[model samples]
Target: MNDSADVSTSPDAPPVTIFGPDFPFAYDDWISHPSGIGAIGPEAYGQEVAIIGAGMAGMVAAYELMKIGLRPVVYEPNRIGGRLRSEPFVPGEPEVAELGGMRFPISSSSFYHYVNKFGLRTRPFPNPLTEAAGSTVVDMNGESLYARTLEDLPEIYAEIAAAWDNALERIAGFSQMQDAIARRDAPEIKRRWNQLVHDWDDRSFYDFLSTSDEFGKLSFRHRELFGQVGFGTGGWDSDFSNSMLEILRVVLTNCDTDQHLIVGGAEQVPRRLWSDTPYRITHWPVGTSLSSLHNGSPRAGVKAIRRADADHLEVVDSYGVAKQYKAVIVTCQAWLLTTEIDCEESLLSMDLWMALDRTRYMQSSKTFVMTDRPFWRDVDPATGREVMSMTLTDRLTRGTYLFDNGPDRPGVICLSYTWMTDSLKMLPHPVERRVELALRALDNIYPEVDIKSHIVGRPITVSWEADPSFLGAFKGSLPGHYRYNTRMYGHFIQDDLPAHQRGLFLAGDDVAFMPAWVEGAVQSGLNSVWGVMHHFGGQTPVDNPGPGDVYADIGPIDVGD
Candidate 1:
């Protein structure tokens, strides 16, 4: 689940890679192994493990460890759900604006496994011109164009699509690589992927597009259109300077398309895990939950972490309460390690610290407002079409998402989803001002529609960059940082770490192959589970080979090379 990049090539030139030259390990395959992951002996059962952050990664790791008879105490200063936040704009309503982790791609099987496990209902997310999205209006250069299908757009759009396809197929064997990925052909995937990593790791996503012969053939207007009306996920000009590997991972893994959003709220996944008793384990009651394991609510934010003894670490909560645990798993954003929490200088190795400090997070802002009803669904008698549709524009609003709760129920709209500089522009504005700015942008797009008349209750907007807890929306690595990423991604392997860092573990989207996807968080959690199990002399069932057990054969190619 990494980002993607572009590569330059002609139809007759050598096939290029898109995601990266790095091996995109099939975490789904590893987790699905028949033998099941390794387990600790009864002697080590019921031990205490501290988990920071109650997000997907922390919750998943805690749940799995609980299944093995370990006691996991989660600490969260704010609400339980971390980035998967769903805000209820109005009281006693089913409508909610997903403040974080909205859309999930079907390719993220690792994340889906838990969703399916919990029987959470999901619906196709409305993205761009997709049927599920209803209708799309792309406004650019003061001109508004409506499209129910790709064909409805100007011929320039089709040409751009063709160029993109040619660039992907000719340079990266896009279809073939996806096929290899679907088949879980590790050897073939590695061989094809490694070459891309080596060649494109240092290249920018924009570089890939500009250097391509297909793109070169097109007028600059086509390229601008392509950027404004991106495929699958939508406009990515904000990520133009990002490593091509980041873009490649999104496209190659199918993480950008065929997406679904959890019904009710994505936060329910972790919130339910806290109280749901799915299975029984030794040393705990048959119906034990994470909340019960901690006696009640989670601890406040961690203030500091330092070694207390040779075999234990002390965690001090915000109230200055110190507790010793055999191990600690940090699932918070990497920046929090250095900025929010005070850690002993020697707590982590210099290499690991550098990796954590250097992690670059992309700024993201989302503004959501609830309407009394599905006002956008109303058809204009004069135009014979819905007044407003899912919108994509180069304006200040950027990308907008629409959510219809029901025919009569209230609906929510993500007025804007701006990234990088676009997101930064709203940093100084209050929620009300931000909402006004978005309404102004929409007013221009749909001059005939009175969007403000339907506003109900209050609006919720967030700038992740302004939030200290998260620091930023998610990691968006730059070129030539593959080695640093690899270091963080594989930090769970305690054998490779120095003795002092052995008991500490890292698990989050940032430490995952797919930085922005929940699937990466899930996989990273599972990785830590395997790591902690091994640290305590636990063993997976002989049939279920852990990731580390198979690392020598299928691990990602060393970034240094």
Candidate 2:
């Protein structure tokens, strides 16, 4: 069935782009994400909502806010699209980069929408079929081997006729169920669905599969295949955070919608949004350090000790660019709101903070080797001779984490999906040493591809986990992380707190959909806008944020005092 899933394709296209376990996420999938379900926003107009990040979530919020007639000003300290990057190295050499997380599941609905919104082409990327087969883990004795080639694999997987159909159908069914649940308004039905989500959220898919011995072993084996097709691993193995479940649902639905890749790369997407908007999106030296809040209260707006050296919400740049907002909607991570922001200790509970700290955040590095000549062909990297993703009758597996790209750009460019986030903590090297280690790993994957030797220029190393700007790759919400308990946005915005319009809004992965990939960020932006719009109780316009707007969206964020 895996073979059958691998649809026949035109010779001129990226081999894996057509279909199968190796296809990348499409950009048109519309997920019924919480934010996608019902937009949050203004009871009035001329309200200011600041979207901190420029990724999909933030962009979605911006769009929603505009629709609601709220003036949203986006504040990005770096290029938009958060982790998306593409740059010219040796003048002629153009490389797309993902300093943070990258990769789109072909079935993710929300991802599909963004791809279309940006008009970025999503061509199939090279798979092991077109290139040479790469490597993944295996037992020393090779007993637990997971091979891309069926010639050397077990019979169970080869029973592709049944297992393949069952798994795909099951996965699809799960998607439908989730969609149904998302669309319904019944409290009891939602309660049951949430129960299932919560039950699964407490342990690994491995644990659930353990109910059946065949399932246990098959799942373990299936995990290996995931690597081959580039799904990769997550912390869901132990206990899945609430956000993790949402992420899974979203990625699984992309094939059914339309998400676009912005032409010229993702960074261009946000840049366009920022430029097209009437407000300014200037970069300040905002990293992961803490900043002090001062003279803050319900009656008067909050003032802060803005500093350039401070990596957290500096609200000021070393270049003396300290500005104020009537309303600020942070579009970073929810964790940023929890740890990086400086506010009263009473804003959030200590139990909440402690509970958050227990969840371990994995790290990974994202570096791209874009050269003038595609030197990957001459040298073969596999243990034996094999053709990667290009040929029809060839070995198939993962590419550079990126699913597809324009045909003009032939070589692979691994972005955020490289998944070095959790691994960064183990990288015992500076930029130079890290680059060497990465090259070694890349060479291992594509032996035919040589970077150190044919490498044109410097390989860009971005530490999403280490970057002071972004402490982690994404936001998280572990099991039972209920928004009501935290007086979350749904309720917080309704509170008669004087801080509502102190220009403090949170537009991170936590705002809405709390933990569901880029969808949360987009939703958070909308949530913050809603918070601000509702704060004024119809006093302001509910449309695009203008310079005159002043509202912040950080009601529930928990930064250390």
Candidate 3:
């Protein structure tokens, strides 16, 4: 559903972008600055920096580092784009399934910077209660309610929405903090947010809801309904055990509201970043792109990482080729450090290692099928409502979204998008089995629709937790994990770090305060860019200081040991 307390969208009101409550740096402004990201000395020009994983974070770091004269040697075991994966149902066809990050929030300004740079198009995602979805179906405990908007739903849905809004305002000062963020008030944001970090870092999202007086005034069923059909997006019960601060950040920054889907697929952003040449590159010649720099492909998957010397780090690829560089940016999941790669213990301190090892990642599963046409749009004569709609249910198919390419063209439907326990239920099942289960669930909601008749191609499915490269879908900080997030997010600023940990920098959505968002990945990549540049004595332009330059004054708060 949509957040009832969303900021005013009027022309005069300041837009609510992801200007952080933590860090509070304007990454979009930094990247779009006329002076460019930064400049490195001539000594650092053409020096190779190893970047592991060709994901959004990896590609962004590679692209920016390449633009600033450094040669970024990228390594990837899987396909590029990482979680921004878009798989086509038919080879060379426009019909595709976004298996990874399908939704993009307008507040993710840094990510949109790259999207705008690549000229990728976007339209509002078909979220549960959004206009783009046209209609929504919320099925709870065997009852189904169809709504063109939140108002069309039962009175209880509105009560849940109001209760959530009241809780946020009463407990979190939602509007004031959002206003601070909108105005780019760093000091005010830090003041308000650091307090929240201190207070809510150890609490769970469920704890925040259950303990709130507003929610407590209502029945347990109200809370259950709230969890099943949550504000901004759909159900968030999967994240109930997650740190309240994490959920707070999402709503405060508007990460869940006003989200859009990248037209064609979200994967196009990174692919374009890989191939497109920047118009304002520094030391690189005209038409030089990451594609050209690596001769049209990245290096093989990284096998291990070790300290070659006090001043350099060595990376070994799957092909057994080992190379030492002054700097390396690892944009892969932090869990991979222990599982996928044979990383040396001395590369990081025990505290940092604990942070990395203790990091918890949530599981996710999605199943999609391409249909002959958008038959769901056809209206039902008896009810005068669409045959089916963007669905949210307590059944196995927790969320079902429709993608209408065109009336004539084949349409794609994400039959199921589930997380945590629901996702685990489908992990052992194959694509066909997963599709069967999702169809079974959907059948209960739309008994007369005959959905199977419209299906044209084989269904696609993915369980990110099953992937060796990505141990889980994305980082979901548990209660009291804020210290770990602080440790990871601040690792880029290495002046205080020991020599062993200095050259190896971390960048990814997982490393960011706002994990599972592309903006987090993009910002983390930019932070690593600044770290890598500074490792070689590079300096940002005076007019456009980098994140590292302002980090000490406004970095993420240290919750505790």
Candidate 4:
């Protein structure tokens, strides 16, 4: 989906992965090391640790904690996978609607470590302008244009793409920073990225584009086109108000390019991690797993958390049962601390609470339908082109995707995927009405194709903001929120913290430098694992220091209050 000119790397250059410019640590390498993440003292064996959610972050923490000889008592209000939800269109069927976290970039090595551990296969996601998509159609202002590649598009689109590339190179030093990340040069990454943080922290993505000399020279229509069909993905006008640093981190880390989709569903990674036995585990017997320890299911939803004593914290579930633990890991959305749970104020410092409260979440919606066959692959006799394509448009149904199962199996179509304002418009609509509105929008594009005639069964839809369990989809940091992110991300390093906040830990994408990505969730989870281990008098093998072990040297820069 990238519209930028293909900047080819040297044939011998190392492939870029999400080795952070913020905290240039090799989480993927650390986890894969044979020595294991770390070890706790024998006294900590079988000790209980409360985990507040069953999402990827919580599951990763729980799995690792179980491996290191601790009992992880998981509590989930809903299903196993949080935003990695994959709902079967028809009950018991293999086909599913990925309601959240559908596309995963290859640079997410930390996340892929677990996916490979569980043996989950992956295929190229059908993103616009990609080979997997086959073709793409861009529709705006009552005009439609189809393209198989960037070269096939009109000259105006090419000019807009060039303008974007020029802006990144001139304003952000895009290539130099990416080269440092690919080479794993920590000092260079810090030197380059810290400057970006200092300069762009208070600026919005739109601000960056509007002020760039390259974009300034172009017409307003060019900027609008860039927003509607952004590089490496679809529309990003929704993120125009977010911090420029946030957008820069995404591109520098390659979070938007060369993505893949889990074969069954993204949810399988967390679900399998919960049940899969580790090859090497301490204290627990062979074949022991997080599932076996919990009797095949996690505990009920947590209702409150409070400090019970100097040595322990107490967790009360929705069922009114109370349990005490020396360590607790909270992996839910930060907002839930204020809305859903009755958390003790004294559990955290006032500054930390402010960060949690200030964190903003973006709204997202997806609508999907199953069809009798892959009718979209059929070529139109009159136009000599496929009846439809991966679509990006200004209509209410902002983006539409087609999923082809085999020739005999039923096909799936994501009728619409929208964010922010576009998503809010669908918030009041039901699944039937969502499908109706999406169909109406598509009919305007493909009037000759009878899309409704090929429908097979019921449709599926989700609005993340509507769910009380998750107020919104994921974190989208606004301008001037870098300090808040810094505060939340560094909370795991509790050495300077007062006694009251010592044993509690936070881990999730929202608490990471790169939010709305699975790698961030996984890396943050590992940080909590290190924090919990240290809390119980544990240490990483001297050969493999944890994120906390190297925190003072390579942690994220403090951009000041």
| lDDT for each residue of candidate 2 in 1-561, tens digit (9 for 90 to 100) | 123332222455222221111111111221223223222333345444545556656666665555445555554555556755555444453355545434343433444455555556654323332212332222212133434444344554354224433453353344343333333323433343444454444444333334433344465545444323322222122122233343334433332122233334556545444434322111112221111101111111122222222112234322445554444555565455445544434333455445344433445555555554444334335545322222111021112433233344545444223333234433455656655655554444445544555455565556567765567555454544433224343332535543322335545554443343454444444455455555455333333331113213212223223
lDDT of 1 by residue, 15-58 (tens): 22222225355556555665555567889889989999999999
Better of 2 and 4 by TM-score: 4
Ranking by lDDT: 3, 4, 1, 2
TM-score, predicted candidate 4 vs. hidden true structure: 0.99
After TM-score superposition, the amount by which residue 454's alpha carbon in candidate 3 deviates from its true location, in angstroms, is: 0.7
- The C-alpha TM-scores of every prediction are 0.95, 0.63, 0.99, 0.99
Q: Per-residue error at 88 for model 3, in Å? A: 0.6
In Å, residue 446's CA in model 3 sits off its true spot by: 1.1
lDDT by residue (124-168, candidate 3, tens digit) is 998888889999988999999888888998998888888889989
lDDT of each: 0.84, 0.40, 0.91, 0.91
| Per-residue error (Å), model 4, residue 251 | 0.8
Point out the higher-scoring one by TM-score: 1 or 4: 4
Ranking by TM-score: 3, 4, 1, 2
Q: Is candidate 1 or candidate 2 better by TM-score?
A: 1
Error of 4 at 545 (Å): 0.4
Report how far residue 206 has shifted in candidate 4, in Å.
0.3
True-structure lDDT of candidate 1: 0.84
**C-alpha root-mean-square deviation, each candidate:** 4.2, 10.3, 1.0, 1.1
Q: What's the CA error at residue 505 for candidate 2, in Å?
A: 3.2
Please report the TM-score between candidate 3 and the true structure: 0.99
Spell out the clash pairs found in candidate 3: none
